[model samples]
Target: MIPVTRELVTGIKLTNYKDFIVEHLEDCPKEDKLSRLKHIWSMPKFGQLPKKPTKLKLLEHTRAYLLYLVSTTIFVDASQRSTLISYLQLLRDLDEAGKYAWGAVALAFLYRSLSKVADRESHFSGLATLL
Candidate 1:
């Protein structure tokens, strides 16, 4: 087995962002988080859900939106947050597959952006290897 380095763990940490979103799903008000998530999701794509995102898509969207909120409304200096914002925008504009890909890419970008604050070497490493 490949040794689990901090580099590997960073990707794992990025996934935690999804969990964070799920945990805070109530932050957005649209009946509930799942409803808002489905709405945000279906806006860009019209098809069956992906196996990975079927249940988790809303939480992920919540996570992405939170990232936007923090990067813009808070004191965090996230230069790369725009990549995530752009990814979300693309999700709103692009077709289904493209939106899905952008969703994944948005998380990767947000992770890289956050790593700039907490861990630099690990952030870029995560971006190069994870996404």
Candidate 2:
């Protein structure tokens, strides 16, 4: 099993208004959490789910998955980015802004895993490469 850190879990809890998403996973009956998450994020400025998505229907699955990960999980505050930068100092995969962008995406996944917000199987796994 992949090891999840306590900090990651706490960060997610904070984001979800102290809801212990990990602890409640067993009770939540929604089997298709990914679909629900997609619907949630796809809502527009009025914050209402549309009868039919206005955007491209074919790519909705992938788009929803990415928004799900980005909106619900990832957080990159100053301190968090600093720590990542320090740990990955030797590598030069991205410049400052690029590194920060990647860090934000990574933190989202880390939060999702630690909080058990959605099954790991439901993640947008190839997002970084595709982007």
Maximum-lDDT candidate: 1
Summed backbone clashes in each candidate are 0, 1
Query: lDDT per residue, candidate 1, 16-65, as tens digits?
Result: 33443334432332333222233344333323434666445655454455
Assess the local accuracy of residue 55 in candidate 1 as a C-alpha lDDT between 0 and 100: 43
- Per-residue alpha-carbon lDDT of candidate 2 for residues 54-116, written as tens digits (9 for 90 to 100): 543323333333333344333222222111112122121222223244444454655554454
Q: How many collisions between residues are there in candidate 1? A: 0
- Compared with the true structure, the alpha-carbon lDDT of candidate 1 equals 0.36
- TM of each candidate vs. truth: 0.22, 0.21
Q: lDDT for each of the candidates? A: 0.36, 0.31
